[model samples]
Target chain A: MGLDPVKEEQNAALHKMRKRVIESIGRNMDLYGISLSTGHLYGLLFFADKPMTLDEMGSEMKMSKTSMSTGVRTLLDLKMVNKVWEKGSRKDLYEVEYDWYQTFTDFFDIKWRKSVEANILVLRKSMDEIDKIANEYAEDPEMTDMLQKDKAKLRDAYAYYEWLDRLIDTFENGDIYKLVPKEPPAKE
Target chain B: MGLDPVKEEQNAALHKMRKRVIESIGRNMDLYGISLSTGHLYGLLFFADKPMTLDEMGSEMKMSKTSMSTGVRTLLDLKMVNKVWEKGSRKDLYEVEYDWYQTFTDFFDIKWRKSVEANILVLRKSMDEIDKIANEYAEDPEMTDMLQKDKAKLRDAYAYYEWLDRLIDTFENGDIYKLVPKEPPAKE
Candidate 1:
């Protein structure tokens, strides 16, 4: 049987819409520490009707199976995609997380939380070191004063991290949706 | 006059503390689309007592004055740093915005807002295109159903961006402080 013109037109229209949005996604992916190609791959999987195998993904993306595998691995690590078993299928199948809010939370929960924790660790250690120095120079008023100032700076930084930690918790626990609802409130 | 031993010790201690924090800043700069070296330069300026000239920044960073100029320009464009007039000094001096909250807001306001706006623009265009297709296929139930589904998906994505736009406004207008206070409330 030949292709139906009407079905082909519908597919073309949908593909065009997906392409535009995917282009934007690919561009913004760098903000989240993801590569452009990987972002596009995620977008492809996102609009797909079913889980896709690496071979299928490679074919769809026009990328080598090796590259598709690596991209899928990155997405899996970020919790942006999932591997699922398909009955009678020997190959692995992966599906994208369709919930954008969940994807946002998962991405930030992993990347931002790691950066925040690392910075806080350094801040805590440096503050302790400053306290030690201040104690050593307690007899010198000038040294004590300077060290105190440095300690205060570190303390301020620590406070910011503390706030960030709470914010990260909000994302991880879905409290962010309470603040910014997933759906907009009804018009008054 | 020879350097005072006590003063030297104090400076050494302060440098050690700044170095540790700067290292973390440098590492995390990639998240904000900044180069590691530029992040370190910003960190150096953050801890400096006064605005630094290109010559001073280059010497301090062990980088060429040309590279320092380029880095300073990037920071200036990001509003993370400012150029100030120094009486009797022909050399331009720059200082970092010391308020971490302000810096955070500024960075996100510029970067995230741009991404959010661009995505929304594309979304709007794509949704409009879907609408055109739906209108053309109004008599075809199967085509209408598919187009309507795609429109709903795009609408869902648009809602997320709308929420993000509000979140960005909160940051830009300093209302975020009302939600996540700059400094935690004083212990009861």
Candidate 2:
């Protein structure tokens, strides 16, 4: 008797929009590379009453079993979602974090740290090889000038990324959240 | 005649180093969800005196022509590189920016506006849906409590994104570049 008439109509509208969004995000998966189809996977997970399995994500999207496994792994890496293993099922079940705070943490753990570290390793290796070559052509005036500019460009970007890493680490581990609670205390 | 052997040789090293850097970037494209083999594409372009063609990028990597085409399109969208039409050349020519400032400007131009707009649209859709739901469930005791929490979270995130959009918008039309140079001047 108390079901909202207005809300029921709005839900009807929302359902249509949500489906379209799911399709668009799915179509975009090709652009991101990999056979991973996140739109359908995440869409089903979001509206789910309980955590879902890799098999469920695969079957619903008509995606291959292998691709679904990898896609879920990537999603777990990104923290866009999470894995919840049921005691009786003995299989991995996934759930999306509706909370923004958790979402940001997921990004921090992967994109900012893991990816940054990997990039730096590659850069250092490349720099070492370049170092040897530069020593060989030390007498070329024009080439020397060009090389300095490129190195400085790379060095500056590296420095910037380092600064960002430290900044995010500080805040992410620090209690910045303590200062930003939404609810102010009610005055007596 | 005016060059130092040690310094000039160091510059030579940087050139080689950039190739390594570019090569590494290409190889790890999958890690970042990039569509193309960024290493192969950039590795070829890194030292090329002239721009390359779609056929060249594909043939060099031995990947499918269709995959190469899609990859190029994604790279073009990011503006990390650009397309050039050489005089007396029929096929499209492409090049990557060696200069840091030019590259950053290109990236900002192509991405800053559109990415923010897309994110804002996502937020607005979610917000509007929540509000619609909120109004309908305003009188429900438990729902009203949950709605209040959700609204505050949505509002805070929306405000932060709005501020970020404004900050990036200031960079448009070359206003910010003049006011804030690539490297700020030393304070007196």
Per-residue lDDT of candidate 1, residues B105-142 (tens digit): 88888888899999999989998898887788789887
Residues A1-188, candidate 2: write the lDDT tens digits: 00233543545544554455455434433323324356467655655446877787677668787877877777776676788877999778888776645555556556556656666776666556655655765886566565555555456555544544553463467433333332433559
- Candidate 2 lands at a TM-score of 0.59
Q: Which residue runs does candidate 1 get wrong by more than 4 Å?
A: A1-12, A139-142, A186-188, B1-13, B138-142, B185-188
lDDT of 2 at B84: 92
Q: Which numbered prediction scores highest in DockQ against the true structure?
A: 1
Candidate 2 CAPRI grade: incorrect
C-alpha TM-score for every candidate = 0.89, 0.59
Overall lDDT per candidate, in order of appearance: 0.81, 0.58
